[model samples]
Target: MSILNSWWRALVALIFPPHCPVCDLPLGDEKGPICSPCLASAPLTSDWALRNDTPCDRLSVKGCEVRVVAMLKFHKAPQWRHLIHQFKYHSRWRLAREVGRLYGGKMAGSLFLSDVDWVIPMPLHPLRRMWRGYNQSEELARGIAEQTGLKVETKSVVRVHYTRSQVWRTREERFKNVQDAFRVAHPERLAGCHLLLVDDVLTTGSTMRTCIQAIVDAVPDCRISVAVLADAGGGS
Candidate 1:
């Protein structure tokens, strides 16, 4: 059965070659959803190696004492912007997973994430998840878990409210938009566990702030570290 499946996949690839999500270039025999050139040109964050006082330090001021790190700097980089758009909005699940793997591989040896006991992807509202078919954050989290060997706890935290898009919202508006938006579904399950919160992007840190607050409120002893794929400029 495995051999047949491999053969089928190879025949399918020959008929419809995979292309890089960022540049739309043919992937040919490449393994990832991104072509080699696009992957080489990815806008990586310089702070990936930092253990403390990372570029995402400003996130700590938003009511949560969580440490933060992101894989890419999402400004003035057309390739990254395009890749994020495709992964988040175009149902590019493969792209999301591949990007997450790339980021996880880079950060696997980081001392900051070494003590993380569990990984939790920021949840999407039920309606939105149904519409999108899958949560990109969860896909990313799976990739991270694959490299870090951390357990992924997807059910503990959830988005209770369906807020409007934060794309054009002001800083204050963004903060207000996600207010009371998240809830801890099983506080007991998360008590005293060190968590790594995974997200696709960090814009104003509003959504992550609210989510972290919910987790802390439920499990006061639980410590959190955030990991995002990109940092879209705004709100420090």
Candidate 2:
């Protein structure tokens, strides 16, 4: 059976060769979603697992203690932006997870998830999730969990209110847009657990603030840590 399955996979690969998501070139021998040549051009941040001030200071307002580690710097170059759009807007969830795996392996070697009790992907509103067909953040979290052996908590917190796009909004506008947008389910179940919130990108930190507010409101003692695949405005 195992040999037959291998042959079946070989046949499938022969029938449909994989191509790189970024350049659309035949992947050839590359094992990653993005071809190695394209992946090398990605703007990776200097610090992958180290506690960085960029994201930490962004959400550290409202007297909440937060730590952050960002993988990509989110360069505004066309290739980088297009790559994000491919996964985020083009339904490439596996690309998102594969990107997560890229950094999750490094995190496993560091103290990033050492003390985290839960890997909580920033929840998407049900309507948005349904529209997109999958939560990219959750896929990223799953990839990280696969590497770090952390538990992903999908149902504990949810986005109750669907939000308008925050891409063009000012920092203040973004905060107002997401106010009271998240709700914690059965807070007692996660009373003292340490939560490592995962997101594909870190923008103005408004959405995260409200989400953290919701979680802390429900479970006051739960520690909060933030991990983002890209930092849109990390050091601003």
Candidate 3:
């Protein structure tokens, strides 16, 4: 079965070559959904290396702080944006997980997630999830779990209200869209837990902040942290 699987993979690879989403270059080996050069040359922020960073500061609400780590320094480059778009907007689910796995491995090398007890992916409304077929953040969390040795959590937190896309909204508008949008379904499952929220990107952080506030409000004793594949650099 193992030999057959290898041959099957090789045949599939030969027929449908995988390309690095960031550079649009064909992958030279199985080690990539992203080529090493693109990964190395990409603008990475210092969130993973430092405990006190922009993501942490921006997510602080009412004097309560949320620790965070991110892999990329999101830029305006089309190629860079496409890397996220391919996995998030397109049906490139495997690419999304591979990105998560790659980023998770980097986070594993850092002290950022040292105290985290669970990896919780920001949830989507049932209507939206039905339309999208899969939740990008949940896929990301599972990938991160593959490297971090932490359990991936999905059901405790949920998006109860439907929301419009945040892409073109103003910062204030973004905050408004997510207000009171999430709910904790089973507070006991998360009580006193150390949660590491996972997402694809952090721009204004309205969504992430609201989600964390929901978790903390329901399970007051749970410590909260955040992780993202990229931080687009917005918010306080």
Candidate 4:
């Protein structure tokens, strides 16, 4: 049975060679959707696991007591930006998941993240999700769960409104865009739980702040942490 499986895999690979989503290079037996070179050249943020306050400071200013961590520096890295584009626009869910797994493995032993009980991906509006086919954030959370053995809760929180894109919006505009955009679908499940909110990227952080506020409002006793694949504004 093992030999047959191997043979089938080999034949499948021959028929469709896996390619790196970022660089579009042939990925021969490489374990991820991104090439090694792209991964190595990606701009990683300062080690938040060691210092820990750099990323959280910005959230703290916003009245979020949550622990925040981002794995990559989003701006000024063409490779990383292209990778994000692939994951977000091209339906490369595997790429997002692989990146999440790598980051989650690093955070697995971190003092701040090791005790997280639930990994919750920032929810997308149902209509938007239907258009996009799948939520990139949820794929990322699943990857994090794969590494950390944390349970992933997808239906507990939902994006209630269809907001405009934040790409060209100012900081204040961004805040307004996502205000009251999220709601807790299952407050009981999240009550008193330690949650790690996962997102694809952090730009102005307005969206995350709104989501966090909704979660806190629904489950007052829930302690929340945050993790993103990239930080576009570099945080505080």
Per-prediction TM-score, please?
Answer: 0.88, 0.86, 0.87, 0.85
Q: Which stretches of candidate 2 lie over 4 Å from their true place?
A: 1-18, 51-55, 76-78
Which pairs of residues clash in candidate 1, taking residues 3 or more apart in a chain or in different chains? none
lDDT of 3: 0.82
Q: Residue 129 lDDT in model 4?
A: 90
Clashes of 1: 0
lDDT of 2 by residue, 24-98 (tens): 789998877788877777677646455443437677646468888877765644456666677889988888888
lDDT of 4: 0.81
Residue-level lDDT of model 1, residues 1-236, one tens digit each, is 99999999889878988777778788777876778887787778755587854335555543347677778866746677788789888888877887778888888878878788889999999999999999999999999888877889999899999998988899899989999999998999988888999998887788888888888878888888888887675544
Per-residue C-alpha lDDT of model 4 across residues 1-236, encoded as one tens digit per residue: 99999999789889989777667789987876777897787677646567364436545434348777778866656566777788899887777888888887877777777668889999999999999998899988998889878899998999999998999999899989898999899999988888889998877788888888888888888888888888777646
Give the clashing residue pairs of candidate 3, or none: none
lDDT of 2 at 195: 87
Indicate whether candidate 2 or candidate 3 has the larger lDDT. 3
